[model samples]
Target chain A: MIVAKRKPFDEIMEMLEEYKKVLVVGCGTCVAVCLVGGEKEANILATELEMARKLADNPIEVDSVTLERQCDREYLAELDDKQTDYDALISMACGVGIQFLAERFPDKPVFPAVDTAGLAVNQAVGWYEERCRSCQQCVLAWTGGICPVTMCAKGLYNGPCGGTNLGNCEIDPDQPCAWYLIHERLAKQGRLHHIKQIYEAVGWRDTMPRTLIQPGYKKPEKEEAK
Target chain B: MSTDNGLKSGSNLEKILKAGHFAFTGELGPPRGTGAKEVIEKAQHLKGNVDSVNITDNQTAVVRMASWAASLLLVQEGLEPNFQMVCRDRNRLAMQADILGVYTHGVKNMLCLSGDHAKFGDHPDAKGVFDIDSMQLIAMVKQMRDEGKFLGGAEIEHPPKIFIGAASNPFAVPHEWRVHRLAKKIEAGVDFIQTQCIYNMERFRQFIKEANDMGLTEKCFILAGVTPMKSVGMAKYMKNKVPGMDVPDEIIERLQGAGKGKVAEEGIKIACEQIEEFKEMKGVAGVHLMAIEWEHKVPEIAERAGVLPRPTVE
Candidate 1:
């Protein structure tokens, strides 16, 4: 899942203070699964915000709405009728959802209510940790199920860092060194012998810049020439 | 020396919730088997930490001690229990009677839910009685409070006053369904809402804004629920084993980033940080802490977050 954490409430309130009537939009897909943009959370937040606004004596008018998926144009269209009622749009979706709302509602200001973290999976009931970087590449096959890029503190591709001691990473003595874990796993599979293979020392892409596509996909157009 | 003390005042929890910027709550899963002692012990430990204890009725499809029984125990022990009554376990008749039973015992808080499927619990063969969903239950309670009559049309001798509440899991699929449920619950006369544990504060902030825009925020008190994971492995289990919960990846990364024994400390620290963040933000009333098995860590978390005891409510 595209994991994103909700921004702190005070920051949100500060951003929202400019408007009298604020519309909070929640996205159901990615943010929903992560409990970021889901409907229930949206309502809870709306209730708290309204209460805070009232308590503050500002008495702002707030509206809560959740779209099936904020990334889609069709879902964004659903808000077309109600879009004008609010002075601002506070989106609960990931970065993509916020921008989509912004693009769809050019007249209104779209603010991101959540900060998009990297991709993650639920580790357990109340636990979720990062497992992937969405690096636009797949390398899990070569390194067992563990991803060295995300798990390793140093992000070293080859093997254990020199600091690894007693199966724990030197950076945080209490934490299992990611390399130690990788080494342990490889050893268990009798693949520790593979660790000695001379790896081609290749550099990863030098610069990693974040990018977002507006309305992400497009169909191929017809050829101009006959 | 302060460890393993007997029951404290219910105000401990109240104070904690009010002290924080936002509040959180979660169900106290009954013991794995039928034993009042285990459940009672958990409640006692959780008592002063959480705003209110939600004694769950057959959580995760598992059959265990009855919620009413457990809630009654909590109240008798001077603790506030948010009795989670699911329609899946009882018919309306039993439910009505149980509601009366609990209220008389001074257990006023409740979270209406449709119990999990029998197959989902420990006993798959168990029969499920979803006589009502959360909305219907809320509606029934509201009618009892407002009209002074039960679903059976019998006049209540003296209508009970309860802090009516309901549950909402925004992480459930068909995301719009979560909103629809909230609207329905509010319409049914819910006074407050205690949501599924949330990890993503940004989403929660947006959630608040949306609810405000929809005018739903005006209707009730919203308490954000939080559960501090004991370990990274435990976090993984919550993600894999527990249904209806959503833990964001950033939190996991941070936890996974923490080394072994440090993860627990880090989890508590994260919770404290979230609590602090919630307190500073607008549109939040209180936080309900659900420390789960780490109930003892609650006081430390609260204290660290600067949510110390108030001078005592009059």
Candidate 2:
């Protein structure tokens, strides 16, 4: 799932600079699962903002709302006319959702409260690790399920650099070398020869930012009179 | 020396290799700060003694003076510099731009390495941009030079003219596959191969033998890397700590036998012995002395190895 971290408190306050009435928006999807921008966290942020404003003697009023999934326009209709009560809105979702809110409320100032890290998996209750860079091209089949593009320090599709010591990466002793794992997995399968398979220089053209269209979906502009 | 004779001159390092000279190249770790004083001074000790000095790009992922700039600085001192480029930092566009930039500055030799990760360095939070790995990097640079076009097929006037190099670590995992990997790098247009630091003499000898059997030596100049252990602690650290580096126990034993204060001298003696072995090792073209943070000792090491009186291309 997409993982995001809260923007530093100072930065969040800075984003609401000069705003008395603010809306703290949250997402019920990925950001919520990561515990950064869910409804509970949104209330905590709103309370904190209220306390900070009261302490500053500015006494700003705040409203909190969490959408089912902020990326889709339909879920956002839950706000209806109530969103205009605030001078600005701070999105607690990922970058995609922030852009969605901005586009939906073109006139309202929308600030991003979270920085979208990468696609990550939950490692522990409070810990998450990024696993995919979404490079669009996957080579896991050749690498024994290891993602060299995301794991290797140099993202070397070939193998570990001369720097790998033991099983850990030369860069970080705590991190296991991605190539080492690939070698181990391939060796266990008696497919050591697979490790020798050299991948040519990756043609990056296919991995460039691209859009996927749903099949058989006829756009209104392309649809005939029917 | 029948092995030595007049040969074609390309880059200074290439000229030395072509002359059948036992070439020695030193590593110049760029300084973290802007002042080039320390780097230039360190390089001064290497000027007359080594064939070509290598300037590292942010070795260990620590920010340092740009390797290209350092290489240019060494050029000003009448010394040849092998500018090293790492893949962990830039994309193809920046890489191609820097290639042209380095060539314009008269830096000739290039060492293409997949740089260490940023997580190891001071800035663990910095984003890594490994747009291309070392092999692809080698092919791309070759593309620029031979085809006069970018990796993306865009034509550029006046391609970078320089010798290309890549690294090999026989001690890396799947150690048996290292030599075959060298073959792949050669196929990618590498002109020279600098293997990881040598300590496991037996393994390196085997690696060289296999490389020879594969006829890799004829395809590219292979320089075996040797780092002089500064102390018993260093020997132990590299042997046990550094990844892919195997400092045999016997060498550490020799260092320990050096008693207390003489370990440094013993390390140099060991390095000299390695150079002597490299001179006779089949398929080994030269010795790349990696006196990391110990550039001052390069001259003495080269002199002790009897590779002094560096061949003059002119």
Candidate 3:
């Protein structure tokens, strides 16, 4: 899931200070599962903003709403009527959701309330760890299901560098060395031959603002003229 | 075995090792600034005492003068530099360009390494660019040197003729796999391997034996790495803080038992003993003396280790 964390309270306050009235928006999907930008968080933020503004002798009115998923246009249609009276919109969703909100309400200023971390799995109620970089190429089958691209600090393609000590990374003792884990897993499965093969340099497709057209979504070819 | 007549790169280090002489190499870290004074001064200490000097590439990830440029400085001083390149700061294009650039400047030997992570460096926020690991870098250089072609399969007008070297760590975890890793590096076309510092002789002996059993010793030159412990504190720091460093407690206790002012002498004595052992150990071709920041002590250590009067090979 896409994990995100709320931006610092001071930065969010500064962004909304110029507007007298604002609407706080939240998403109900990934951010909600991560416990950052759900309906409950939006309500808490709205109440805090009102109290903080009142104490500063700049009383302002704030309203908040939680949509099913801000990335989909159908769910975003719910904000058409409620967004007209606000001076600006504050999005507590991930970066993608915030951008979608801005694109829909082009006239109103949209400010992000949370910083999108990365693609991760929820470890516990409040903890999460990154699992994949979505580098557009996956090599899990050869590496015993361990993603070296995300797990290794250096993202090494071959075996471990010279810094693996006692199965831990040189950067941090608590972080287990990814190659060490891969080696043990492969050795246990009797697939040690997989790591022995030399892997070529990774062909990174990290061009910014990448767009992926799923197989069925790609445009159909033009019909041949008879 | 390769001989001087069939030298691959004609580097002084390669020639010495090829001539069946016990090779001696030292390491020199470039200064943090752009000045050449430190490089030149350090080069003077290793001039005739060692076969070749390794110019480190931002050792420990700290920013410094570029390794290739520092190596050129050594070349200008009539010294051969085993220029070190790391995959931490540049992509493949930059790496290949630097290899070609350094070769034109008279640098002959090259060492490929996956550098220390930038998080441990002076600029912790710097982005690390590990476009290729050390293994692939070795194969790429070999292809460029032996086949006269670039990694993209484009023919080069004049490809770099480099005697490639790579680092090995026998003390890293999954201990039994270390020898197999050496075999993979050998298969990748590395001509020589310099291991991590050795304080645990028993473990190192086992590693060398395994390498020999697997015929890795006959394929490539294995140089044992040794660093003199300056004091008891340094030993403790290496054992506790440094990764892939296996400093046995006995060595630390030995340094402490040296009494107040004799610890430095004791450290050098211990290094000399290890070098002496490496001289007799089978499959060991040389000793890479890394007196970090203590380059002046290299000549003295080399002298006592009986690797001097350095060999002169054609």
The best candidate by lDDT is 3
Better of 1 and 2 by lDDT: 2
Model 3 regions lying over 4 Å from their true place: A219-226, B1-5
Most DockQ-accurate candidate: 3
Instruction: In angstroms, give how far residue B70 of model 2 lies from its true place.
Output: 3.3
Taken over the whole model, the C-alpha lDDT of each candidate is 0.70, 0.85, 0.92
The best candidate in terms of TM-score: 3
Model 1 CAPRI quality = incorrect
lDDT tens readout by residue for model 3, A1-226:
9999999999988998889999999899999999999999999999999999999888889999999999988899999998999999999899999999999899999999999999998788899999899998998999999999999999998869988878998889899999999999999999988888888877789857787778777744656210
Query: What is the DockQ for all candidates, taken in turn?
Result: 0.01, 0.50, 0.79
Give the candidates in order of DockQ, highest first: 3, 2, 1
Number of backbone clashes in candidate 2: 4
lDDT of 3 by residue, B1-314 (tens): 23246888889999899889989999999999978998899999999999989999998899999999999999999999999999999999999999999999999899999999998999889989998999999999999998999999999887788999999999998998898888888889999998999999999999999999988999999999999999999999999999989998999999999999999999999999999999999999999999999998887898899988998986
lDDT of 1 by residue, A26-92 (tens): 8888888887779987887788889998999887888899999988888899999898999898999
Native A-B contact fraction in model 2: 0.69
TM-score for each predicted model, relative to the true structure: 0.53, 0.86, 0.96
